[model samples]
Target: MSRTAIVAGQGALPGLVAEALDAPLVYALDGFAPAIPAQTFRLERLVPLLDAMADSDVSRVVFAGAVRRPRLEPEMFDPRTATLVPRFLGAMQSGDDGALRELISIFEEWGFEVAGVDAIRPDLVPGPGVLTGEPSAADRADAARAAEILAVTGPLDIGQGCVVAQGLCLALETLPGTEAMLDFAALHQGLRPDARGAKGVLYKAPKPAQDRRIDLPAIGPDTVAQAARAELAGIAWAAGGVLLLDRKATLAAAEDAGLFLWALE
Candidate 1:
């Protein structure tokens, strides 16, 4: 019998993924972990962990939720991981996307197939449409502008999301993440005389050339509240290109905040 392993991280996403599969073996990262009980492993000694998974007849692996890259030191590395340090270091230097691709390649070398969360739970990718509240004309315009901005930045390995208010670029996501960008937009929105307190939309999309089988853009209930804090009109993401975590709660949050959730084309 074949078994699948869920290499989980923090948040509801891990639980949701576990629920989608049958008796999935759970492996939690040392720092970032799933809410459910799991066998914890560290990044430095990954080869042994892969060996363990192989022994258990695990043929597939799925990653979910937020995992920060671990800082590596020479002393901490096991023999196998140590040998791969040169390749891993080069991947990190390229960008987040590069790091994921390298990890995927390593797993393939171990004879395991890497699967995407959506493969198990297709419901998480909402169809193209408005889910909760309706978007205004301005919101649609801002959403379009945000998509265009992300397309330009995605190829540069910059970020997957941005905030546009009143057709003005308020903030762009970088290594600091989407929440930080939202907070910055909240602060800067009213500073401009022309855009004083002008409402906008938070936009999210997968970076072009990103490997969807690993890390795709995602949003949840917390996102709605964050956009509301920014005093924005709504949130939008590329339709079928992002994960809508905890669908019911996310929609409820959007409705309560009067923020439209747009799954844009």
Candidate 2:
């Protein structure tokens, strides 16, 4: 019947990707229908699922969602996974794009064409603008500084978002993510009382040469809400690479929150 498959990751992007490709999703979690009919399986059972798809005459596979970097833990390892562990680790030691390219090569060897979410859902890409409205000059200046700081941090594969206020880096997202970083900054009295209404700037960009298939930088309505709660002034993302999920809703939310969103060229 000429079947196709989608390996799920995280967020709404996976669902959108599956819909666009007209493929059945391979649900990685148990008993979750995932807004689409999918064959459920566990992560440890990936090899078997791949085998099943191959046996079913699946010709292509699309990867979507936010797959967090897997933590090294003994309990999560399986015999089949163990066989590929060394190679995976070697790729990690190399570079993010290198790792993704090598993994894509492996998939090609299995007789499946691998594509990214954007291949199916290009509309999700944000356009150049202050998606909400024009940022104040101060906010724009802060965003520029935040972008500079983020440029250095991104190559390390640390995190994408950063917060800047009055040219000072108020927070840099580590493992805790953007929301947590903002909460921490607020708690630490990072902003002065006089700077209460001052707008903080958030800068998000994909790591230099990031693997688009796996780690596409994403922002949506939740990001807008978080920035609003933190008294942030503006949000900036890489123009071509960043993914803006729920574009209209996200813009509406940002405008409602009095926050500015811009796609950097």
On lDDT, the leading prediction is 1
Q: Write the per-residue lDDT of candidate 1 for residues 121-151, one digit (tens) a residue.
A: 8999998999889988878988999999999
- Candidate 2, poorest ten consecutive residues by summed lDDT: 27-36
Superposed model 2: Cα runs more than 4 Å off: 1-3, 29-37, 69-79, 88-105, 192-197
TM-score each candidate: 0.97, 0.83
Query: Any residue pairs clashing in model 2, and if so which?
Result: 10-65, 10-66
Number of the top TM-score candidate: 1
In TM-score terms, candidate 1 sits at 0.97
